[model samples]
Target: MSRLVVVSNRVSLPDEHGSPPPGGMAIALSAALQRRHGLWMGWSGKVKAGEDPSGPISRREARGISYALTDLSQTDLDDYYYGFANRVLWPVFHCRVDLAEYSEARMSGYQRVNRLFAKLLQPLISDDDVIWVHDYHLIPLAKELRNLGCGNKIGFFLHIPWPAADILFTVPHYDDLLRGLSCYDLVGFHTDDDLSNFAECLRRQGLPDPITNGVCQAYGRVFRCGVFPIGIDTAEFERLAEQAARSETLQEPSQRIPGCKVAIGVDRLDYSKGIEKRIVAFDRFLRSNDHRIGKTQLLQITPKSRTEIPAYLAMQKDVAERVGRVDGELGTIDWMPVHYINRSVGPSELAGLYRMARVGLVTPLRDGMNLVAKEYVAAQDPQNPGVLVLSRFAGAARELGGAILVNPYDPEAMARAIEEALDMQLDERIDRWRAMIGRLREYNVYRWCDDFLLGLDQR
Candidate 1:
């Protein structure tokens, strides 16, 4: 078997205790690397001035897998990561063209970082190594490696939505990004809509249509594009939920809100998450079902991210204000309608909370897969599972058809969905949960990893 090389914006190295990183994607990728005795390389999540960006890679070995990390300079972090990748690609890909801040300097910095990554990585690559690059931050990596005369079979996976040509064209030098994708042996997206949108981008650029057979001819090379909806480590999460249900910690939250039903929403504090919209819907739900006012509570757990960005900071304030308004408008002395926690919850505690909730609200304005939806389903009780009120825009909505889908933009519809979920019967909940859990059991994160690698190998 050929050696595997995995690269991404940030590396998830195991801690000193040898415990693997959190999150299903990290665990799945780490497992895959171990199986192939692979090399995993990425930025070290450190920034310092005067240190060489292309300095000798920091190397480590753990559990039969080699890990390589490189630190970025402050300028590289600002222009490449914060500037182009977050401000430009993230917004444009999420169909927020108005938010994309494009600049020639940022674009140049993005390209320069990719080149630096390639320069640092090329010497470590074996001739037979199969390279797998992850996310928008590293889209130009394969192109840079090819420029450096490396021909290893490289694959790229976009973990976010791929916007249509009109939306993508909002960025300057969009052609460069498309051409960079063409350098890959395989390009993967989270959903058919994303894959189709990518194909349309190619067609609008006068390239041959790739939709017919998933083969594209562009920039004097041919590559394949396909959909690979990501999944979670369902069984592990299920076990966590089970353990949490039995633990004393679950009693603490339940005791605080005695005789009340909980609806949980967990997400990173990002604009695309629709946290404010969800809060509005929850408020509406409370108003419509006045009898259940004091009996129903929404526990929204959101952890802050990318605090340096102005848009994110503004959104954080907006969401906080919205939460406060909802609580003040609907709360009595003994009951608050919305309990907003702006911090991360540990995996065990999160699973317990999911299990405790009577409804799981995962309404994202736009999301690649929204693994929180899957995790919510996985953490449910089989006998009397909680209802999942999901957003139709999420890629997970396609697979988790058992969820009560609602448009995130429509507060009324979402409020109705929430009511329906709360009023759902035991038998119906079991059947719906069965429909989703069966699919999850069959196509877990490990299976997703295998399918993509198999596709890359075949290519």
Candidate 2:
């Protein structure tokens, strides 16, 4: 078997001594690495002074998996990661062009980092290795590898939305990015919508059209592209929920509120998450229907992300004020309408809360795939499951059609959907949940990884 080489911006090194790994890509990629005797390579998540970006990779071995890590300088973190990747690419991909800050220095830094990665990775490559690059941070990496005379079949996957041609064209050097993307043997997106957007962007630039079979000829190269929506480890999440239900952590919420029905939202503190909109919808639900004010509660646990970024800092304040206003207007001495938690909780505790909640509000303005929606579904009680109020813009909404879909931009619509979810009958909830679970069981994270790898290996 050819070694599978996985590269990303940040590698999540698993804990030693046989403890279970973290969730999402960490767990999925670790399984793949162990199976294929692969090497995981990326930044070490440490900022050091005067460290060479293209220096020799420091290696660590854990649980039969080898990790090749390199440290980044503070300037690289600021210009490449914070400036180009987060400030420019992230917002543009999510269709928030207003937040994108494009500059020549930022683009140069991004290119320098890609060049550095390729230089460091060149010596690690064997003739039979197949490389897989992940996310927006490394779109140009495959091209850089090719420039270094590496012949391995390299695939790239984008884990975010792809904006339309006009929105995408707003970024400087958009053509260069597209040309870099064409260098990959295969490119993957989370949904057909994103794939179509990519195709349309190429067309608007007078590039050749992509066929229905997912082949496109651009920049004098032919590449395959496909949709591979990500999924959670459903079985693992279910087991965690079962264990969490019997733990003391769940007892805290019950003891605090006794019998209040809970609605939950878990996301990072980001402008694109529509956190404030969700809170306003919940507030609307409380104001319009006064009968359910004390009967229900909303617990939004958002761990802060990218706090150094101005947009994130502003969003945190905006969400906090919204939560405060809702509580002030609707709080009784015994009950508060919203419990906004800014810190992250343990996975087991989160599972317990998911099990406890009557409705899971995963209403993001835009997302690649909202894993929390699937996690909520997986954590629900089999006999009496909670309803999932999902945003139509989320990639998961395409697959989890059984969820109560709402437009995140419309607070009234979201409030109505939340009310519907809350008022849904048990039998209907079970039917919806069973349908979603059936899909999840058939197409979990293992399947996604396998499918992408299989596609990458094909001619």
Best lDDT among the predictions, by candidate number: 1
> Model 1 Cα displacement at 422 (Å)?
0.7
Clashes of each: 0, 0
**Alpha-carbon error at 273 in model 1, in Å?**
0.3
Highest TM-score against the true fold, candidate: 1
Clashes of 2: 0
lDDT (Cα, tens digit) per residue for candidate 1, span 373-421: 9999999989879999999999999999999999999999999998899
lDDT per residue, candidate 2, 131-187, as tens digits?
A: 999999999999899999988999998999988999999999999899999999899
Q: How many residue-pair clashes does candidate 1 contain?
A: 0
| Model 1 score (lDDT) | 0.92
Q: What's the residue-level lDDT of 412 in candidate 1?
A: 91
lDDT of each: 0.92, 0.90
User: Each candidate: RMSD to true structure?
Assistant: 1.1, 1.3
Off by over 4 Å in 2: 18-20, 50-54
Off by over 4 Å in 1: 51-54
